[model samples]
Target: MQDIRCGSCSRKLGEGEFISLTIKCPRCKTMNTLRVTRSEPVCPSASPIGVSIEQTHHPVDRRQTSYG
Candidate 1:
C-alpha cells in the first residue's frame, strides 16, 4: 500500500491503489488530484478476493408497546 499526502500541507490523506481520484484535505482544506498508472502488475492472482460481512443484532425495547 502507498500513502497519499496533501500537496499543500503534506498531511496523510489516504492509502490505497487508485487510477484517478480527487480528494479534499480535512486539515488544510486543499483539493488534491491524483492520476496513476502502474508500470508493472502488483498481484498475480487470477481471481479477485471476496469480502465477508458480519451482521450485528440490536437489543429491543420491551417497555414500549406498538399501537398498530
Candidate 2:
C-alpha cells in the first residue's frame, strides 16, 4: 500500500495501489497527478517449486494527432 499526499500542503490525501491517478487536494485545492509501476512478489505457495511469475509494465503515450 502507498500513501498519496498533497503536493502543496503535504496533507494525506489517500492510500492505495494505483497505476495512474489524478486528484485534487482538499486543503490547498491543488491538482495532483501520479504515475507508478509496482512489482510485487508472487506467493511461493501458489506457484510450483521451479516455476516463476513475471510482471511487465508498458509506457503510456499521450500524443494528439492532427488531421489537415
Candidate 3:
C-alpha cells in the first residue's frame, strides 16, 4: 500500500482515504483539502525488476476531486 500525507500539515493520511478529504489536521488544526495521486515510473533497465511509486499532494479545488 502507498502512504499519503497532508500537504499543509505533513501528517500521514488515514487508511483507505486517498482521493480527497476536507478535514482538519490533527496536529496543526489547519483545514486542509487534499488531493492524492499515485504514479509509477517505467524503468528501461532489464537487470532486475524494481518498483517505485510517486505520490504527490496538491491543494486543489474540492469540486475537482473524486470525493466531490
Candidate 4:
C-alpha cells in the first residue's frame, strides 16, 4: 500500500512502474541485487516467472495403441 520511490531521483513510482520493478527499499538507490519479497499476483494479471507446470495423465494413450 506504500508508494515505492526512487531514492536518488525522489520520484514516487506510479502503478505501472511498481508492477514492473522487483525491489522496493530505501537503500535500493545504491544497492544492486537486493532480495525483494515475491510479489503476489494482481487480479487478472500474469503469473510469476520460473514457474513450471506439470501435467499428469492416465494410461489412456498406452491402452489406445495397437501392437505394431
Candidate 5:
C-alpha cells in the first residue's frame, strides 16, 4: 500500500485506524465506509462479494433478565 495524503486536510493518514482502510480517507476520518466501484486498469469487470453475519454474545451484565 502507498502512503496517501488526505484529500481534505492534505495530512498523512499514517496513524491509528488509518492503515489499510479501503474507504473513507484515513485522515479526514469520516464515518461512512464506501463501496468501491470498478474502474478500468485497476479492477476490471469487478465481481462483488458480500456476506451477512449475525453474532450473539453474552452482555456485560450476564445476569438473567426478566425478559429472558
Candidate 6:
C-alpha cells in the first residue's frame, strides 16, 4: 500500500487517511498542507517551475557514391 508522510515531522500516515486540504501533524503539531499528484507526491511549501524541451532528428543517405 502507498504511504503518506507528514511533511513537518516525517510521521507516517495511512494512504487516504488525510480527508481535508490541510492536516496537523499529530506528532509535531505542525500545520501541513497536502499536495498529491499522479506522478509524485509534492512538498507543500514547494512551488512549480516552468520547463521547455526541444528535439530534432537527422536522416542519413543510404545511396552508394561513385569515386574517381
User: What count of clashes does model 2 give?
Assistant: 0
Cα-based lDDT for every prediction: 0.63, 0.63, 0.55, 0.37, 0.38, 0.50
How well is each residue in 1-68 modelled by candidate 4, as lDDT tens digits? Answer: 54555544444543332223433334333221212345456655767544332222122122455688
Candidate 4, residue 7: the lDDT equals 42
Ranking by TM-score: 1, 2, 6, 3, 5, 4
| Candidate 2: tens digits of C-alpha lDDT, residues 1-68 | 86887766778989887767778776766777777543444774463334222223223344679999
Candidate 6 local lDDT, 22-47, one digit each (tens):
55556666555654333332776666
The worst-scoring run of ten residues by lDDT in candidate 5 lies at 51-60
**TM-scores for all candidates?**
0.53, 0.52, 0.36, 0.23, 0.24, 0.39
Backbone collision tally, model 3? 0
Alpha-carbon runs more than 4 Å astray in model 1: 37-68
Clashes of each: 0, 0, 0, 0, 0, 0
lDDT of 4: 0.37
Q: Which residue pairs show collisions in model 4? A: none
Score candidate 1 by TM-score against the native. Answer: 0.53
lDDT of 5 by residue, 1-68 (tens): 34434545555544342312433444445422212232345355555354322212221333566873
Which window of 10 residues has the lowest lDDT sum in candidate 1?
Answer: 51-60
Output the TM-score of candidate 2.
0.52
Instruction: Candidate 3: list runs displaced more than 4 Å.
Output: 36-68
